[model samples]
Target: MGMKDKFQDQAGQRQQQANDKTGESREKAGQRSSQQRERSSQQRDRARQDIDDTRDEMEDRFNQDYDA
Candidate 1:
């Protein structure tokens, strides 16, 4: 092959490798974001449950005071 053709082939190979690496990095990033979202959702659920429990306790105390 000519010098120009050899250079073109090498450039194409390098481009393909760069593209593959980028795809892999993007996949890993997506997975990490999904995990973070799940963790945040779990935390929000726990916080809501705590608030509901506190409200129930407060209502009970208020009812007791009113009855007395």
Candidate 2:
């Protein structure tokens, strides 16, 4: 595959892995105490934000590469 396709594939894989980790974290946090649960919830939000940022960066890179 070309560099663009390779980058797209890697981005998709990273997104899927992030989603899986977030789901697992949420499931485990369900059994935590109130304070711990709150902490885990915050962690989940951070993870989501990280995923969004990565996705946006990947899209920007992909666009730049393809537009060239």
Candidate 2 residue lDDT tens string, 9-39? 9999999999999999997777666778789
Task: Judge candidate 1 at residue 5 and give its lDDT.
Answer: 100
Q: In model 2, what are the clashing residue pairs, if there are any? A: none
User: Which regions in candidate 1 have their CA more than 4 angstroms from the true location?
Assistant: 64-68
Clashes counted in candidate 2 amount to 0
lDDT of 1 by residue, 1-68 (tens): 99999999999999999999999999999999999999999999999999999999999999999999
**What C-alpha lDDT do the candidate models reach, one value each?**
1.00, 0.94
Give the local distance difference test score of model 2: 0.94
* CA shift of 31, model 2, Å: 14
